[model samples]
Target: KKRYKAQPIVLAIPRGGVVVGYQVAKELGCPLDIIVPRKIGAPHDPEYAIGAVAQDGSMVLDQKVVKSLGISSSYLEEAKKREIEEIERRMKMYRKNLSEPQIVGKTAIIVDDGIATGSTIKAAILSVKKKNPALLVVAVPVGAPDSIAAIKTLIYDIVVLATSYSFAAGGQFSQNLVQTSDQEVIGLLQKASGPQ
Candidate 1:
């Protein structure tokens, strides 16, 4: 409230973030929505993210990683194309016929269950920044310390419940780590939006 003075809209990173962001939006009495950003991983090591791309084609690349690995422009372009397609698919599945909530001049709180490499969130932040929000904040349950530090310069504020140097994947911090389905995401988005 110190920053926004008004209720802020929450943009939940889908799959897992919907769960966390739903409660936040409910508690804040604000609208809840999503932003889909797909990670562009390394060639051989798919788990190692080199960058991420948003639904609008906005992107964030780890130049150091790309340069060290000698990642080619062709590969990056291909990966970005594929990731943008995925983001579009997910956005369609989640939002369906509903249009995205208006965030211009409003505080945007981007929430996720946790952060790992931070590639996805970074992409989400850059995408949201393009919309010209009043303030951009990242709220998560936990995150890797290095990942948190890496993204600190990009966002207005961060609210992380926990952080650790030895952090692994987000599932490790959860008691019941179920793979959230697209249907679940759709249901949550509908519930958050209420009757039209």
Candidate 2:
């Protein structure tokens, strides 16, 4: 609050990031929201992200990786279409009746559980950038050193608790690697948006 004159709003990347964002919003005494950015995984290895597509259809792709992997333009087009559909489904399930928070002229803090390749978070940042926030920040518990370094070039203010040299994935740091369900995301959003 003291750092920026503008109002701070927390925007979490669902479904794992919602839990972390809720806590951050609660601590900052600000409103919490979600940003949907679906990862465009590699053809053979689904876990390997070649790019990501945001809710507004904005995409961030690793062109070098795409070319190196020989991923066709048609493949990317199909992947984006499929991801956008999933984004729509998620927005419907998670947002429900809630309207998107007013981000223009406010401090938009994009929160995620952690960063691995930084594809998803990069897409989220691009989507939020269109809203014209006064300031953009990325907050996460942990992230890979290389990923965090790459992300640093995108945003000025980033709060990362830990950067691990041995970082394999975000879930590796957690005691429980269980996937956060749609129900859990809905519940957390409801709780955060409730009496404060």
Candidate 3:
């Protein structure tokens, strides 16, 4: 609260982010929401995110990686289409009422457990910027040094608990980093919107 001197709407990058953003919203007595961004993976390397698409369908791609890997345009187009479909599905599943928070003219804080490739967060930031928030802030528990540095060029306000030069994985920071399920995400959103 002192940082901004005003309550900000917390937008979590869902699955894991919802967990962290929920607490932040509760602390400030502000609204909690989500921004779904799907990573566009490399062919045959689904875990490797070469790009990402936000819930609003805005995307950011690493042109260098795309050219180096010889990723075809057809592949990228198809992948984006598929990811967009999944994004819509997730939005319906996570936000049952289909109503999202009002962030225009309000400070918007994007929260996540950690940042890895930074593709997803980049996409989310771009998407949210279109809504014209008074300010945009990213809050994460930890992130890779290089990833965080590159992201710094995009958004000025960043709050990270830790930065590691040799960050292996987000799971490394947690004791039991289990795969976050859709049900868990739904529950958190519900609790946040519940009666005070």
Worst 10 residues of 2 by lDDT: 167-176
What is the Å distance of residue 53 in model 1 from its true position? Answer: 0.9
lDDT of 2 by residue, 1-196 (tens): 6786799999999988998999999989999999999999999997798999998988999999999999999999999999999999999899888887899999999999999888999999889999999999999999998999998888768999999977766756985778889899999998888898
| Candidate 2 to truth, TM | 0.95
* lDDT tens digits by residue: candidate 3, 50-73: 999986778999999999999999
Off by over 4 Å in 3: 5-7
The prediction achieving the highest lDDT against the true structure is 2
Measured with C-alpha atoms, the lDDT of residue 91 in candidate 1 is: 88
Pairs that collide, model 2: none
User: What are the runs in model 1 whose C-alpha is more than 4 Å off?
Assistant: 1-3
lDDT of 1 by residue, 1-196 (tens): 5556645999999889999999888888889999988889999997898988998888889999999999999999999999898888788889988897888889999999899889889999989999999889999999999999988999888999999876766866885778778899899999988863
lDDT measured at residue 81 in model 3 versus the true structure, 0 to 100: 92
Q: Per-prediction TM-score, please?
A: 0.94, 0.95, 0.94
Instruction: Please report, as a residue range, the 10-residue window in candidate 3 with the lowest summed lDDT.
Output: 166-175
Poorly placed runs, candidate 2 (over 4 Å): none
Error of 3 at 151 (Å): 1.3
Q: What overall lDDT, based on C-alpha atoms, would model 3 receive against the true structure?
A: 0.89
